[model samples]
Target: MQIQDLPYPDPGVPDVRSGSRFLWWLGRNQLGGQIRSMAWGLLHFTAVSAQPFCVGYAVQAVVDRSGTRLALAGGLMALCCVGIAVGDTFLHRAAVTNWITAAARVQQLLARKATQLGSALTRRVAAGEVVAVSTGDVEKIGWFVEAVSRFTAAALTVVLVCVGLVVYQPALGLVVAVGLPVLALAALPLLPRATRRADLQRQKAGRATELASDTVAGLRVLRGIGGEDLFLDRYRRASQDVRHAAVRSARMWSLISAIQVLLPGLLLIAVVWYGVQLAREGRISVGELVTVYSSVMVLTYPLRHFEEIAMAYSFSRPSARRAAGVLSLERSTDTEGSRPADVPSGDLYDPDTGLFAPVGRLTAVVCGDPDAAGRLAERLGGHPAEAGTTSVLLGGVPLDELPLDAARAAVLVQDKDPVLLSGTLRELLDVPASGDVEPRAALAAAQCEDVLEALVQGSLDAEDPLDARITERGRSLSGGQRQRLALARSLITDPEVLVLDEPTSAVDSHTEARIAEGVSRLRTGRTTVVFTSSPLLLDRADRVVLVHEGEVAAVGEHRELVLTEPRYRAVVTRETQDEPASATGPETPSEAAPITAAGTAGATEADDDGAFRGALEEIEETA
Candidate 1:
């Protein structure tokens, strides 16, 4: 497809059996572009090669004193120059088009794969690897694709030029022909070493990128715990490793480049020296000697393309492999028997843990192990667990058996750490929805009026709060604001089933209670499942399920469980058996106020929870 017709209607199903196969698939799809580029490249190289022959003819015409032949030679020389200019311009244009189109095609394919896999993409592949494939690897693959046609054209021109020279003067022609191959092959031995070094450098750089990504994502927490320097030092070491590997790789490539230059110079020297001897012996004319010299110089230019093609292939091969690896990932629902069907309204059930969220009710899941809670939340949305586990079913139909779009429409899972993409507040909240709830209503339900006020006050343009732009990942806002904003976006979707994991983990107790009531009021008749340990949210749940070691351990109201089950009380209140029973008493709305308003107002729920858990553990040990 042409560059203008970009964003292919269908990028087409790629052959991802291997990296080489994936590259071949891309080439086949863009065969028309490759042919167009090759045609222009051939014209350009042919016109350039003819210039030396025209120059020789002009000199011979001058020696013969023939005005007619001299004029004819001058005309041909000018004609060749025009051809060279036009062909060169068009050739560059075509080659560049090929490069851009190929890169665009790969990017589209990667995007499609990411959308299909969703959060599972990062689970299957490293985040850094995905970023590298999308950014750097794509460019490298395009470079190789674009280089192929030029390399072929240059090779053909070299072959034809050698044939023409041999027909005109066999003695000098044979010398040039044999020397060209030797020069081309001289860098072969060093290529493997260079390629190996390059691969090593790419690996080191990917590791460094991953380390930097992790450190940045948790920079706030690191600073809170005074561990920023430790992470900074680790990243510094990784950066140094990448730098050293890059230097080693560059050193090898430089050696190869030196050999290429030195050998070509030697070949030119030999050709000139032999041609002069042939002229002295009266075997060849002066025009022929000059022609031979200029021809060798012209041939040197095309020879460089050989090294360029080699370098491109070496770099792009690994990139293609990584891209292929990511594209090959399949979701649980991608297998046979999975098709789109109307979803019936019913409860959400995870057979693996025997935990079910009853329809038209708000359910709270309390699990001490955060990891277990996260996994359970994912399963509730049809995301598969380890192998051999039964799929979560909705209304007696396996969620994994339904098509991805249908499944996502039926159930929406907002992870604990939901990301807010950069855009105006309106754009951020503009997602596919049932259109029943207004943005303002969802915002109010999420208790985000304070967030809105702060955003307007901080905005320099005096735009409406909804029109204000949020920084990337909402970095300009506090953790609680980001959390509440994400919650509002989820509430707007108005899905049939909503599963949330620690939705209010970053807010204070007072705000958490308000958010709990807002969520209950907004989702009054819909099935909502929240995974949290907060007492306020737990007390608001229609039914509370306590999961222990990946199974449902207790099922009852939040207060009933706290009064009856010791384990449940310990988990929810962060209390030990040795502590006074009143400490674990059911917390009423009025009694759930902040311990100290001044101290708790500024402390996030996560920090408060961590401290409470730590203190409870210490008490248990002392008792």
Candidate 2:
């Protein structure tokens, strides 16, 4: 299949053709450019091939003892020199174009594959590996693609020169042509060993890259724990390992290169020696002998490409394999018009824990295990739910069973550290459901007034409210600010089911309390599952389901559970009882709050009875 037919668009795939055949594929891709380069190669060969003829003519002129003819040969030699120089100039130029265009095609393919894999990319491959592929491997792959064209032209030049030598002086031509195969074949035996060495060198290099990436990502934490020296030592070791591997690889190549140079020079000497003998025997004229010597010498260049191409192929083979591994990762394609099954109307079910947030209720899940909560969110969003351990059911349909896109549209999981793509603040809140929530309300609910104040012009310039400049991943903001912004983003989507994992963890108590009120006020009559230990957020929910040992161990109102379940109270209150001192240990902003129990035990029949009241009130208030 063509590269286009691969699971994703990476043009570097091997096709029905092996080396040359695959090259032909690229040639076919940019036939016009290849034609131009070929023409240049031909011009180069013509100019170079004429020199030998000119030399042979000059010798013949000397043998005939004709001064004028010899002078004429001298002039022809000068013209051939000019032609050779000019041809080589343009030949190199055209060859560069061939290389660039081929690399461009492969780059496009890799980019497309990267987009297709999306989030699953990191799960399937190391982040550093991807970084290296995009930066380093892309160029290496491109180098191979372009090398194909030069090798092709060089091969053709060698063939044409050898044929001309044979026809010009049959015996000498046979020597030059037969000797051509020997120089070309000399590098063959070294290829396998060279390739194995190269693969090891590249692997070692990747390990080094991975080490650097890991160290940089955790530089802050590493320093905090006094582990910087340890990580630094590991990095040094990895870098040294890479250097050693590279040296070993280079040693093998240098040996092959030494052979490539030595054998070709020896071959040239042998051909010249044979030609000189043939000339003495009267089988060839003086001019024919010179032509034989020049042709063999020039053919040396193209023959070298034969070995160089072999080496380049060896180095790039590993890169190709890595790129292919990335492309080979299977991606789930969401079919059209599919909705999640098993979700009974609007209920959310965590199949892993057998926990159900009854239809249209505000259920708060407090999982002691953070990982379980995160996985539960992924399951709820219908991402590839892990077999046996992670799965959520909506109605009768298993989340993973539904199409990925359809399930995602129905259920949105806002990760605590969700990335804020670069754009305006308005753009941040304008999520996929097309910013269904009003900007003011979402910003207020997430207690993002400070965030909005920080943004330029409050994103009012665009007709859309969500347009605000957010640096890559919202790096301009603090952890808490970015978290609240991400929360606002999720709230604006207003999916049928909203799964939030520790959304308020980074915010202050006041902001968290406000967020609790804003969200509980906003998402009434919809299914919401929040995983948090914050009493403020827990109190706001209709019911708090305590997840212990990977399963739901307790379910009740925050107050009832806080007073009864010691573990539940310990988790939410972070203590067994309130302080006896009116210091009540620093009276919490949570104390006087109703639903102050879970922080929003505020989930009452009367509260949700006015489910749409918040949306209506916001519309009236904003107006």
TM-scores of the candidates are: 0.91, 0.74
Q: Report lDDT (Cα) of residue 467, candidate 2.
A: 56
Could you give candidate 2's per-residue lDDT for residues 1-623 as a string of tens digits?
22233343445544432444444565577676666666776666677767778888888988899899889988987887787777778777766666666666656666666654445567779988987766677667656665666677788878888898888888878877887787788778888998998888888889889888878756656878999999999989999998998899889889888887888788778878888888788888888888888777777677677777787788766776676666556555443325534333457777667788877788898876687778666667766545456557776566656655667777888865577788777656555764557868777888887876666553445444355577766766777888888887788888888889899888887778788889998888888989898877777889989887777889998756765675675566544333222223326655532332223333443442243244234323332
Q: After aligning candidate 2 to the native by TM-score, how far in Å is the CA of 152 from where it should be?
A: 2.4
- Cα lDDT of model 1 by residue, 172-291, tens digit: 999988988898889988888888888888888888888888888787889899999999999999999999999998888888788889988998899889999998999999888878
Model 2 TM-score is 0.74
For each of the candidates, give the backbone clash count: 0, 29
TM-score of 1: 0.91
Candidate 1 root-mean-square deviation in Å = 6.6
Q: All candidates: CA RMSD in angstroms? A: 6.6, 8.4
Off by over 4 Å in 1: 335-337, 577-623
How many backbone collisions does model 2 have?
29
